[model samples]
Target: MFSPALLQMILVAALLSLLSAGKLTASDYYVATTGNDQNPGTLNQPFRTVARGISSARQPGDNVIVRKGIYPQARTLNLANPGTADNYISLKAFEEEEVIIDGSNLQKDATLIAVLSHHIRIQGLTVRNSQNIGISIWGPGTRVHAVEVSGNRVHHCQNSGIYAGFNRLHDPVRDLLIEDNVISECSLMNEGGRYNQWSFGAGAGLSRKVTIRNNTVSHCYGEGIGLYLSNKGTIEGNTVHDNFSVNIYLDNTTNTRVSRNLVYSTEDQRFYRFNHPASGIQIANENYQGFNNPSSHNVITNNILIGNYIAISSGSYQRGGGLKHTLIANNTAWGSIGPLLHIDADTSHYKSRISNNIFKQTGNVPLTDIQGSTARIEFSNNLWHGGVPQQSARSTSDLEADPQLINGGSFNPEAYRLSESSPAHNAGIKLPEVEQDFNGKPRSKNFDIGAW
Candidate 1:
């Protein structure tokens, strides 16, 4: 004898099941030669192509772990579906091998690889040789977290190797972690098309709230780490070398910290058949007339800037310069084409604390610190390694004596032991340290010489 209450409970249970079934389920997909698309996408019965596997995956917590092989897609592998809060979709490599997603689409002129969906995680895959951007994230106002792109290689892409931001100007992609990925062999070009007519090569747009750490980025056509409207992000522990353009470019950003990154350019591997040099750590203002979107509240500290055109350049144009409140300290820049410190700001509102850095130039025109009427460019405790200083009638105060390094004008980590006779041994300002020691150790004594 079933009671009325029992019947009501059964009805509620059935309704709950219906609602739960509508949500995306946790399913796995494999990719191998001997696989089955018809069967359930399990380890044994894997799908052939990445597009097929990704399409069949349900939303929220649905994951596709591509095994070791080359997977080709007709168009971009679009992960634009909205995932639930609990169930986030993940596309990752099975064993961190050469899991290649070959995006050599000959039919299309340029493929815009956009990850427009929500709560997506992609890790450990080599995305290479695309006509457009290699791996991009266009998630608007969505939390994209724990995207571990480690131990993979990206090369010979036309556009940027890694891009994380929304397509729109205001909204930005947030909470991305790009670590230990080797990005090289990319060519930068000004392809006139849908891609914001003002786009440069590899490093040419806005990235936000992301951490680009410990990766070796080199041999690109544009900047090393391009902060286009990117803010509150930390870029450290990375080696950016051998790019055609600027190394670390900050445009229309604020509250970002770029510390301890080794930025320089070697003889370019020649992605394109051209011959031109580049700069290192170039910062400039964007939107000259319309928007006063200057990259404000940024800190450049403890970096090793070596062998480039210009070590660091502040402000965009010669007259239109008033980008203010930047901190440049404890950096060691050697063998540059232009001045070690070139500030083209117009006003004293361009306040900066330039302290305890080693500026060594092989060329004649050395440190050029342009002091405007309103600009208070505090020069304190900086060790002039070599070259004649740029003598200006404007006040450049507290310039320190030479803190001779053991190995003059050359960087060798093995012989980089701080000599007791060196003035730079303990000559750093006692500010809050942004980065740690070489082997991820704690840096307690104020700060180190350069980015460890």
Candidate 2:
């Protein structure tokens, strides 16, 4: 005989199973290659246009599924609706399907997808071959928040691959996530979009709490990744290469963290003719307008820079232009030119901390401090080799020893790491940010000089 308590427990388990399996209340609308826009958005008889599917999603828990095909729309797909915290409007490719949103026929300056609202997710699609940005999100008239752009292939765009929050008179975007996207071949070739200066591969201007992670950005005529005035953001685990101006640029940003990213340079010789040098990372305050916000409280750590003209630059030359309280640590810089590390400013209050970094130059004057005529710089525990050899700034801990790395005289990615027998090992100043090496290996308690 079964006990009454045991039967009650069995009945409760069965009721919970029914509620968990049948709890889905959201609808899934489909868009296909062979369907008409006049059809109801069902699985078999779906809508043809992506815009039609978006219009038919009546609630926040609705999803718009696009099938595998070439969507050759020439106009912008504007997402103007908002979703709640529990539910978001998702526009994505069908399961394991290859959906290509080809914007080859779009007019110049016409963006492909513009998300003007919050709680939207765009993923697993190919958005490419456009005249302007592949995807953009902004609330020009008001504030927008919580956007996720991931797992997409954006390429061959004439301007930026993915741009955010660069409009005029707009409230800054908050809580943005851009990750695992392959963005390349954004040719900013002076087509009236960027006449004076070119666009970026992926970037945001006037945003906060943004995260850019694990993306591959290459072959850009402008900077690879630029965050202008984007505060409290993090750039991590991205590979940025083959850019014209600088691989990564932070202009007038505050409280930003850049870490574990690989930045290298490529020569096209076009920038040389225009009197521009290929730089790796630059933090400046030259482009601010009425808002004269300083670049402060930013940290750059555990990066690998190879084959660049300048490894990293800080501060500025104009009046009231400089960085304050920035930290640069645990990076490997190999094969650069023209003062591989330069910090120049016209003010005395420019302050920066450079530590535990490896600077191996291609015979360039690796550094010029102040150019410290007046700036406050704290540089220490770094390894320097083979530059034009400028007089280094004063530091408590300095090492001119040869960093015994593998292929130590070349531009290989592993060339700047410390060998077991290297003098740089266990000879660096201990910094809080130097907890890891370039490969994310934990540093020793005694510390190893330079980025491993």
Candidate 3:
């Protein structure tokens, strides 16, 4: 027994719930190499091209499942349909089969896959051989959000392997997840005359709340993973190596966490004769076009950096904004050609902290090359071994002893693990930011000095 108005409200709520449930009920559209475009996009009668399958998936919770084969296209695969927050439109390979989106026939500057809409999931596909970018998630007029690009293999691109950005200052893209993908041999167009200097293996700029994790990025012409002008991002559990420039670069990024990453370079010579050797991690302010945004309040912890020109470099010579309030803690740096940690003079007034790190180098190279102001930088409880002693005066609790790594010469992460009687065991001050080790193990109450 209800009043007329209450009954009316109940009826409306029931109708809205029914519509929402209808939105969540998904339809599957299939694409096969031998099928025809005029088909109904079903399992037996699939669409011939990926574009037709994408066009058929028009509603929320719809899936465009491409079967096993190489589908070469001359035009870019555009994902322009927007889905709801709860029901994402998915473009994925079918049943764990192989699906390659080849862009070898496209123009030199044509991108392979362009994600122009929000709430889309692209997964389990191999994208390669684009003269430009392999996958690009960007929109000049609209703000893209909730785009997940995962479990893909992208390589041999002339420019960036994967890129996402927006140019507008206030209308930045949001909520991007790039994980468990493999990107290599990207930025291949980087030569002296026609080099695309702004390329990377995987990059995201002008975005917020981004998570890039567990990806293997290697052998790129530029930075392995670059985050520029992005805020509140997490770069974790990534293995980045052998890039021409820096391995992991944070340019004008704030409140970002770079942790549990393995960054290294095996190349003895510079990729370009005019360019400097590769660095493990570079935190700088490039100040592209006078943006002047400071790369501040960042946390770099629990990483293994090996055999780079410089393991960790802060500040830039470009003369834009400077590094401020960065915390570098609980990391292992070994076998660097130059200084293990190089802090430039540009970071004069900032209050940065370096603690609980294991800095070791061979030969006459200095452990740290702090060139500029050091009045505000804090150094404490670091285990230093084998290098010209440059940090002894700055830190009182620093130990000059053998870290006794298990196999110090190898490139494996387990090789940097501390031995049973190593001096780096329980030799760190407690820092709240580092709750886990390099392998994602929980840190003990008595924290270890380096990443283990």
Candidate 4:
């Protein structure tokens, strides 16, 4: 036998040779449209259907590029193949906004489904009008990167525009980047398949490292984005609006950052409906199912929480366990009929860090912890307007004063400010700086009054 160093050199040489000689060529693949399946699936002599392309993709690095045009087929493209990290199976749009995957005529109880594939990217296509979810990523560890799902307009589907979760077999679906996609007008009732509205607009289970950003998720039957049992993902810089549920729901999740998102119309401030369907963001324990632990150490900061009943809610639906060490900071909320922040529920002692928020309300108490536990929801320096007290509780040091805003009460609907004679103009408690005002200036003091 050869020496170990010689074996290593031989392996490296073989890898380099494969990288150089086994490179993929675009001209070697075929095209599939509607008509004759007997044709040689080349670009010039293309086959008639997508079914033939699947039969032809027998190798690991083989590609079958779906050309741009209206594909009227209503069948689910179940790719029974796997691609490697180097050679991936690509089913991309021939041209941006020019290719369409029409699922309009799917039979009753017939949903278009893609299943059991690996290392595949569905790029730049309009997948819409189905009985269930328009696009379902069923494979475990599938990477859906840089696909423009705009003007595709998935509607009237019983489920979601694009739903990603675990399969019935409990396979893992992780490391998915759902970006620049538009998923709207999908039904989110109690009855659905595989993925449900109860978890996420699309939910994930026991998965980590998912980034869902820069998408417009509106007018759905469920929440804009619901995360259950998801850990360490960035749900940032997205516009989630007009869903029946919370703009973002975090249940039994942890180490997730929700920032720089615009969530609006989450509340109806009408008198009769006051606190009935009150709109606000919620981070609850979710009844403490035996499967997962309670949510902890979540950083909810630097977002605009406006036109809702309660801006932020912490430690809800706690049975016996406690929600510990959640950071609710750097958020601005206005026009709340109920308390701007409420952390009162049936649970044992809980620990939460409530600090540095901007609350503008109609005399709605800014901070409230009705649990009456000895370890109250901690608070430091938060800005409040409209004569609302900082905390309605009897223990905490509630600062009831003007927060000397730049535009005064005229600019703030709740009329929050530090009067020329008041000391709270810049006299805020010392804290770390996270956000600045509209004028790009840091909080003149160490703490900013409201969510910028």
Candidate maximizing lDDT: 3
TM-score rank, highest first? 3, 2, 1, 4
Badly placed stretches (over 4 Å) of model 4 are 1-68, 86-88, 107-115, 139-154, 167-172, 188-199, 266-278, 287-290, 318-322, 346-349, 362-370, 374-376, 390-447
In terms of lDDT, the poorest run of 10 residues in model 2 is: 366-375
In order, what is each prediction's RMSD in angstroms?
3.9, 7.0, 3.9, 6.7
Q: Which stretches of candidate 3 lie over 4 Å from their true place?
A: 1-24, 140-142, 192-194, 268-276, 391-393
Q: Please list all clashing residue pairs in model 3, or write none if there are none.
A: none
- TM-score between candidate 1 and the true structure: 0.85
Q: Evaluate residue 420 in candidate 3 and report its C-alpha lDDT on the 0 to 100 scale.
A: 99
Tens digits of per-residue lDDT, candidate 3, 394-445, equal 5888888999999986778999999999998888999998999999999889
All candidates' lDDT scores?
A: 0.65, 0.77, 0.86, 0.57
| Candidate 2: residue pairs that collide | 369-372
lDDT score for residue 221 of model 4: 62
Compute the lDDT of residue 271 as modeled in candidate 3. 53
Q: Per-residue CA lDDT of candidate 2, range 1-452, in tens?
A: 77999999999999999989976566788999998999988899999999898887656778899999999977888877777778988899998899999888888778888888888889889998877788987764244678889999988787788888845524578788999999987855543235655678899888888899999988777788888866888988898877777889888788998988888766655543245446888888765565555678889988888776677887574434655788888787777655567777546444678787777765535444346453366778887777434454546577776777777545455766677888888877888866777777787788876667
| Candidate 2 ranges with C-alpha deviation above 4 Å | 1-24, 140-142, 166-170, 187-197, 270-277, 315-320, 348-351, 364-375, 392-396, 408-415
237-259 per-residue lDDT for model 4 (tens digits): 66666555466777777787776
Q: In angstroms, give how far residue 385 of model 3 lies from its true place.
A: 1.0
Would you list the clashing residue pairs of candidate 4?
A: 33-48, 200-226, 358-450, 386-414, 403-417, 404-417, 404-418
